[model samples]
Target chain A: MRDTIARCETTAHAEGLAAGLTQALAAARDGFSPPGRVAALPADRVPPGAAAVRNRLAEREGIGCFVWPGREAERPHHVRPGHETERPHHDGASDDTTTEFAVLLGAVRLGATRRLLEHAVTHLSGRTVGGEPTLRKQLVLGTVADVMTGVEAARHALLTGASVPDAVADTHERLTELDWETTKLLGASGYLADGPARTAHVSRLLADCWVAAPGGTP
Target chain B: MTELDAPLRELRGMCREAARDLRTRALAVDADPADVERHLDSPTLTLIRVASTPKRFRADGSVDDGGYSGSCLARVIAGVELARGDAGLICANTGPSLAGVAVDALGSEAQQEAFYDAIADGRTWTFFGMTEPDRGSDATAMETRLEAAPDPADGMLLTGAKRYVGNASRGRIGVVFARTGRTALSVRGAVVRIPAAGYEATPLDMIGLRGARICAIDLNGVRVPREDVLGAHLPASRRGLWGIGRTFNVMRTQIASMALGVALAARDLVREERPGWSGHERVSARLDAALALLHDAAVQVDHDPDARRPPSVAKLHITDLAVRTTRWAAHALGPGAMLEHPLLEKWCRDVAAFEFMDGTSNIQRLHITHDVATRATAPRPSAGRVTTPTADRVTAPQGAA
Candidate 1:
């Protein structure tokens, strides 16, 4: 399992979390069970990229891609028009949630978040402000290092599985903070409706829908 | 917190009453920013316009509210109450806002008249262009260039682009800062009238503060008459950086006050959502303490407008606190709070704007640390508090005095 996670992290660093996660889901064998031991919804209920605990068991059966309503995605697992019944897929089918999904999603979101920081570093280093590279400024460097530290902290927290509810909640907060801080480093570009900020924002909503509370269904 | 005297206390009560109208229009503006135009005449917005305007320029020429415009402290007091109503709604209102402070500080008698007169009609929107696409808040590194006009009689040619400016597309008139030479002193502000040749502004798609109408501007040799140059008659030293320093110093406290107000609003919403949750005790106590800190910063600005550290500390702390408080509001409302409560969701979005408005948290921290490093050892930030009404006398002339 750790080897699979490391390989996905490498792919996410090179490509993206979605690409890495999709690859892992596709390659896994049919007999495999996700850590959560959670059951899948009906096949039709899943999608182009739903974050359900199903991994390539059948056609288009890769686990990935949780998108809520009114948000952007590469391949949206959206609520169909007049399909209110399937909303638990978007609004969180907490009952279907499992500790394993939280553990896995944390690692996945961190991988994506780390990618955002790399993008920010590239943007800042490429640009010059007041005759100096923005990335070289002491304050900018300090902020970058702070976010790097956060990624580490979040990575450590995700490695542990004790207290599923608290771990999930803490992971959610940590990754979201790192994402926001990294976005600010991109300046006005970060506020664009698309790009790294959008990805980070989607990751936040994805966690909300997938992670469960102490008394939640997961 | 310093005890509010009767007049200031009464002013806060009136603002609290007026804020409900801001809440009434909040969701509508967020849904459709253009809808803000239809609701601009609410009592709360009108009061803000009147209070922000100098007494001599007001249409009614009445200072009915106690010290709403009277002092930095008074405005800070009212800023908190007004934003508590709906920060987005306040940003949505059409008035001589962000630009008004700069014009008041830097404009000459004739220049000030031109600015205020252009926006005399309640319907007119205004813009203050400073931030650029490449340079976030580093105004000193501005690339917008102001060149000599072909014909000296035409004054100057202003050519530059600005981004993240409020009301840029809709503003009939505004002030944009540009550089005439390599030196910082060469930086200057020029007022440009819209509907002229070679000046265009396009609204940017925003994640939040949709009502703010943030935009990107393209200037192609926009003509600026010599008279429109702010601080044209002032000494070279005071023309550029000085007024910016003064404007930011006074404005920071107000920004902090409004940010604190949003924090309070989020706290109240959590209470409203969970009627008997004692988990909020720690949050409430912290908010109360932040309010005191905000008031202390306001007093400090009133006492010495150029004091940078107090405002920096206040803005940095409260901006992040407001964002954190809104997040707490979501958590307290339980899972799917954002999906369930539209207002809380909108607030979470709107609060992010304050973090980037004047400066980001990183920038604010730099200011605080830079100032602390320069100063000798001193009392704590909250020390030497001045509670007297007279301490609020800095901007009193605007109060129909």
Candidate 2:
């Protein structure tokens, strides 16, 4: 069980890194040049690709537009009514963006848990504890069923969180606990660093989840 | 001990038996989406067998044992029971049953013999081709047209298309709703044989209820014999506009019953998996309230066939509860809920259809509010309370009353 969880977690981490690198490469191809380099250029002087990327980021975050100096642009205004001037007009996350982020976190969490359950099902079905399959098999099967139920709850919370404000926090908390429980179920092999299963480790998945989670450390 | 419970108990038993029968097949259409695509071309016989059970159908093509009027409520109970087993199967069962009710209630003696008799054996299927791409619950706005054919013997020529017509691809016969004139108010029903010339059906890809066999039906000047016209010989009031309404009167209840079945199934699973869920005061309270509303709707369906408000109220409340109950079940199940539990996910998706099909929950609300407001103005001894006519009091033949 431990080895399987470690395998899943490693796989998620590698996948996340690959995705991040791909996005970075795409941004570079679009002339954003990554990091602090693009911010130094004038809005109009920026390459079309860079400008396009900026616009997409702005729109998704509910920043409305890249208001170069005093020039305001028409975009979906996501700024809260009272804090319009208190926050950066181009970087402020709107309620919609927050909900989107919550949903994204939920997706990552669900993917990891799905892998965990699949591993458990495969592993437990093949192996037995104490040289007997009956009681241990029942226990494993029952736990997996319970996990299935929890995943559904998390899914509902994630879906509702997309529209309901309070639901986001509820789903985030639910998902965080799910991640922990899955990791614990697999034990030391799940914590193993250099094993053949290290590639499937869940640390990256957990890290990404934390970064996306409400009140996340990152 | 109530009149409603007796029949409901029997219907429930039938539904459970059918569900057990399907489980034995282990089709797993719900667990694997690929099975849905595969079955689209060749529908599995599981649902057809369930629908055909001697318990559901009679030798005369009418539902066995269930009375003509009371059959509506009985079907509702059966739907609830079927839903508990598999919501996709409910779709398949109701697809034909919907057409049966319309034909039995509105078809001429000859029409009934041809259409109903064919399905009496439980092996045949019928489709209700009413929803068009542009028109749904407001079916009066349909674009499908039935024009007077050039030859009198050719009957009516139907042109235009129906989308989301359940069982159309595999049905032996279908009842199509079309505009008799250019005006929206001229809409009427026509029965067409699946094999008729210029008629085409294509299976639709659906998010849920894969077994329902939903399809798009196109009629390119499809000719229907005059005898196939749903209410050709009936009086104006009992045939066209009024006929469809009576059909809905029973259909709406059955739809609500299907939704209730999904909710009941969810509630049962939640109870079994999380036995302590009922111990939670708020959860128990909600369950009690939902069950009470469901039972109240069932009782109203059996006792008050003519009254619009009871069924409307029942449908409105119960469908909403079905969605909520499934969500609650998922919530109770927790993180593991994401695991593919075919029944839970299917029920959730199936309940969504109830909210949209027939008169939408919003439309039901509109009717209920209108009734309440209209009642508020009328002066009488039963002024505050609304009293519906008993089932026998209703006079219209079973079309849209």
**iRMS values in order, in angstroms?**
8.8, 23.9
DockQ of each: 0.19, 0.02
TM (chain A) per model:
0.64, 0.48
Structural similarity of chain A in candidate 1, as TM-score: 0.64
Clashes of 2: 40
lDDT of 1 at A162: 25
Off by over 4 Å in 2: A1-167, A171-218, B1-8, B23-27, B31-57, B60-70, B93-95, B182-185, B276-292, B298-304, B372-401
What DockQ does candidate 1 score? 0.19
Fnat, 2 decimals, each candidate: 0.23, 0.00
- Per residue, candidate 2 scores C-alpha lDDT tens digits across A151-200 of 88776666555556346645655654554344333422222222212212
Candidate 1 C-alpha lDDT tens digits along B334-376: 5545544567767777777777778877777767776344343
lDDT of each: 0.71, 0.53
The per-residue C-alpha lDDT of model 1 at residue B61 equals: 61
Query: TM-scores for all candidates?
Result: 0.82, 0.59
State the C-alpha RMSD over the true interface residues for candidate 1, after superposing those residues: 8.8
